[model samples]
Target chain A: MKTEMAAIEIRNLTYKYQNAEAPVLQNLNLTIEKGEFALVSGPSGCGKTTLCRCLNGLIPHFYGGELEGEIFVDGLNVRETPPAKLASHVGLIFQNPENQLFSFNVERDVAFGLENLGVPPEEIRRRVDWSLELVGISDLKDRAPWELSGGQQQKAAIACVLAMQPSIIVFDEPTSFLDPLTARGIFDVIAKLRRKLDLTVVVVEHRLEALAAHASRLILMDHGKIILNGEPRKILAEAAERLSLKVGIPSVILLHRRLSKLGILEGLTPLTTSEMAAQLRGVLNRD
Target chain B: MIRLEDVGYVYPGGVEALRGVSLTIGERSSLAIMGRSGAGKTTLIKHLNGLLKPTSGRVTVDGVDTRKATVAKLSRKVGIVFQNPDHQLFAETVEDEVAFPLKNFGFPQDEIKARTEWVLELFNLTRYRKHSPLTLSGGEKKRVAMASIVSWKPKYLVLDEPTLGQDRENKLRLRELFEEFMEEGRTIIMVTHDVEFAAECGFDVALLVDGKVSALGSAREILSNVELLKKASLAAPQMAELFLELEGVEAQPVFTVEEAERLILSRLMSGSGRP
Candidate 1:
């Protein structure tokens, strides 16, 4: 298999917030390929969001953490790069849309990042239109962020980040506040963008079922360390029990495992609801 | 009991949150309110406890109209737990946080202490009774918020997005607590988007869409209807959806996992295998 080039490279990265007892991230090493859709999931406060901030140059540059080792995003060392400079190559979307959106209107919100980058008015308008269209929130251009739904506001935040024309985008639990249908819709948009734009996407989310089918790879974090990194199916199947113990398992996977334990489900490990249904039907038919 | 007759709420900023909607929730029955954002689930919930008054129409709780009742009076019977724990928690310690509501209700110090101790023990937070609320974890904060409300022993409990930040273990524990509350005949009206949790809790389902009650029925009836769920911007629980797809089983939607298992088992035993 051909190896895709790395868009993000972390070498023995470690970081500790000032006045903390221990480091949040310790000796973490990872390499994310360009245009790959990766899901970073773990228990809350396990340093997943901290990792994201580190990737977008918010750690040493903006947060003033005790940083060690190196993080290079698109060949630029994050330690040396300022957040404003890194904003052009890697866009960061926070978990709370309210924190990211400060503009009076949706269009202005999307254009905020571009304006900071000193993009011309014509190009900024073009980029804002393109980004809004990508997130399916073009019609909400004139509305206040507070007036929009939680899902719409989140999409607008993503569009705001996308307007900067970043090659990589990192989302911190973008759907934590949304309903399941809306969450799925947001994931669909993310998948579409990943396919159409060749953008590297790293999302830290707990809704594994929504993203499991679309993510190119799944990275499981625990105690601020990446424990399992591989294709979704392989990682889920191999680390079933440990995964359940570390972080909550999705309902379908839990059901599949229970059935398997009872000798009612056999063949082909199922990681999703559809796959589980198919395998379950086959078992009943054989009986 | 809580009743809404042609209720509507237009925010001061001119946003129509809840349209003219009518519904009644009987005492001791749990109801799950499901909807997408901007569907007015929150707005409808707020009306139950008199947090927000209807712009048109009436909202009554326990024979008292919300518009005519003080928030304090309604709060004694109706307790609401917001999504963010920080919003409700203001006390320096967990014990005080749980007792704050009781003190506001004018309970004696001895009675408040007793209730606080009971709730702290009930939620297994006794070890952290003296700990600062700000130092607690997200799940801990949630427990404190729940403990505060449950300590009051309100007749009706309304929880908004109870499982938003909870882990699987915590979620399961919450289900157990809700079941206990139901067994004791306390009314629980939860506003949530978690289909699996909703299904497992065995509550009657209410689908709120565009500030209206789009669909209202038993969990089995509402969740099995895929078309209605789609229109409400909701998804059927994975197990419920899977059971519906089975050949011999005529998609009788069930809320709880145990119910789904029992239905599937009965169909299989009757020689009606997968269709």
Candidate 2:
């Protein structure tokens, strides 16, 4: 049997929006293998969102932009396939939840994408229920979308995309509008769902502290190109050394770097606060 | 000074947003209101101006009851940059959006033009000054919304989640701007959930839980107490947590990297020499 192909592939991709002076995405190349959780981050206006839009055929089709490159999502050429056709394979969650949610109630909103794709009623119901529970928002099924808080509405948006049962999901700054606790809860939900579904996940976020530990790979974009892409720990360590990436290194990593420079602590860099604390505890008691 | 005396707000849908909350925000002070979403942080700030009057109690801004003042009249002293830029941005161009507030506040043509240019440049929006506000990205629109309000130079600046969607560079810029604004003896009342930002700014924090002011103290006191933060459904800053989790490391309240460094250095001298 042939091994499963990469979940997403892009080669020398460059896209320019309508009436734009320069290309937002310039000669970008990325490949996300199956079931890989990748986190993409960069400074504001670094073409992160534009790259996400390209994953599901929104570049040349919906936005009417100049596109030159090849993109394959689950072996289907994104340039050839329309967004509607790619919906089942690749789900895109917008940065703002308000942009995606339109239905009156949460349950109906979760069911919207499935119903549009002509999925059977019973199947839609099953998938909607599964997704709502997966995102830990089953209690919000009856509430109106407008009544839910920013965090809840974002959960609902995730459920809407999850209900489609896509093999890959791209979340664009899903927690930008949320509080720290709520943002952590959102990341937890994403990790849980990715593990449960074995889906490839790509999250574009600024809260690297919360996401760096969960991501299998981290990709940093700047001025419309991927400047760094590799293991999250390695990339984050490198980015911390450079300091100019300004990708918002987690506080723990910065602390680790400071101690290492002082010749106080050494070894693997800690990604989370707890990890750093654990390492410090070992060294402090080593006397 | 802004004062809320047992303020209670019941929404039109009969949802009680705020309940018997009493607080005072003095002039030239920086106050950060933090709570989980839907905990009435926004509702409490809405009472600062006359945007939402308390249903059961009174709110006074600088000795004048909000109930007795019109929103337009109160707006001269208090300007709010709402959380969602889409709600406040209505002008065609970015420059016009920043100028609209100054114009509405009755600034002269030359003053409005000068102030608008100043804020636009301060926010680094000169390149997009002619572009429509709607055409900008989320972070850019947020800056425009903020620039529009700050252009008026209100005595009290109210920011709702000012750091949301901002990257590191912009967040640093905002911290600098807030420092400059507070140095001029103006007050800033910000409702945010960014613990790191709050700790960095050294703002006095008020923890709101279910529309009630549960705790009020300095950012050092409030943010370092993991128990208090947990009660409000928030986590203490990681720096604080690191010190807490490490055993036998008695230190003062640590929230930022610099403080943590100092504490660790003192401990390192006692425990072991530097490698």
Candidate 3:
């Protein structure tokens, strides 16, 4: 169900926090189509988080910052709409899941957003059940949010967002605190969620190695602006220095960069280690 | 110099966060604690600095029983940098935040100032000395926390997820500081989920699972052990996993990009693994 309508569109957006000297996000313009999966990465303090706030209507509304330009979500003007009004169409999963979840139980936490939207009690119950099962946290429905592990708490937060039935979802480093195995599992769940729903996924993460292969588009930000935006491999291959942070670049891509510099390998960059190994097999297997 | 003897801890809520965990960290060594969340890594490290005493078993540093010693006395030998900076930060400025530890430890103003300034420079926070730590980004806050703890020069440094908010360059910088500490014969114990960080530092790894010491050994040998890592719900670093998948030229599960590149180049250049 690919649609031509842009799930998110920005026009010359610039924002600065109240006390901050310079704009955190400056003159950023972009468009993400419905159902598109985009991964955003950059060094710390590079405005990726600020851009996420802008996408979710938290920049000017909740952050109390000076914001300029325009932002549209699902063809609706974000500047004119309150965050409460935009919650139904755009769901933002923050960096710390524990901070976002405050309910007595996992079930109630997931249903909190639905209840806020005046969803009927019957529908709320059904959604809480459906989302908890989808996120694989149904068994922990009775447990308090504080009782779950970091990974499980993150899953619960995602369920809360999923229940809102937003067409666009923004995950702000959702798995930063998780181990590699659990982090990969969360991404797998997200991929499954994408297949099951018509959604635009924007993931802002430092662990790009785990999620690079799944991203259809990669956006690299620096100094409050997007420095590179394109296919994953191409961006990593061409403008790697700007994307120099190790956490965000895949190991395979790092190896590829080194190999290219030594003139040992060239032509295409691999986003995953397995993909790189596949590319190397041909070279290594040639007698 | 840091040792835990069959240490087991049960929180007030009746949750067994740690159990039967025994490990010894030698002086002048770097050890990485790897485990999934709630697998008892944090609980285990808290025992290092007397933040959380073991309900059973024992934890000792330098033959002194941690359970009997005061936290203030233990702070001189073992300083812990928590994952969340806000937990430890209270000063209005970053400079004062780093100084608070030294001053409370009864160091003279000159020593406190010197130590605070040195750590601020080391952590790249000198420019932000006057700024409130609360206003900094997550990465900067993490650095501030470290600077505050390391100012007193403890005998053992226990870091809880130091790389939580850091990128690759920042991690490398932090590794340099860790290396500097190692040179001074200080034991460094870090709890982290960053497998790449573990591999980069060449630390001896202690894997904690369900409050037990699941495995402890050279990170190289253990991180390459896929089955053991899988048992704890952990994955080998991407480089290690890739090396294992390759069908050529005696590849040991390499962990870092440099090691992987060396293996690939040796095979391809010598044409040894070629069909």
DockQ of candidates 1 onward, in order? 0.39, 0.51, 0.61
lDDT of 2 at B177: 82
Looking at model 3, give its docking quality level. medium
List runs of model 2 lying over 4 Å from the truth: A1-5, B248-251, B272-275
Q: Give residue B80's lDDT in candidate 2 (0 to 100).
A: 93
lDDT of 3: 0.84
Q: How accurate locally, in lDDT, is each candidate? A: 0.81, 0.86, 0.84
User: What is model 1's DockQ versus the real complex?
Assistant: 0.39
Q: Rank the candidates by TM-score, best first.
A: 2, 3, 1
Compared with the true structure, what per-residue lDDT tens digits does model 3 show for residues A132-185? 988777998998887777777888998999999898899988887677787888
For model 3, the superposed segments whose C-alpha errors exceed 4 Å read A1-5, A241-247, A261-263, B248-250
**Candidate with the greatest TM-score versus the true structure:** 2
DockQ of 2: 0.51
Candidate 1 residue runs with Cα over 4 Å from true position: A1-5, A60-62, A262-264, B84-153, B183-185, B254-271
Model 1 C-alpha lDDT per residue in residues B214-248, reported as the tens digit of each score:
89988878877888888777888877767666642
Q: What's the C-alpha lDDT at position A253 in model 1? A: 73
- Per-residue alpha-carbon lDDT of model 2 for A203-256, expressed as tens digits? 998879889999999999998999999999999999988854368888888889
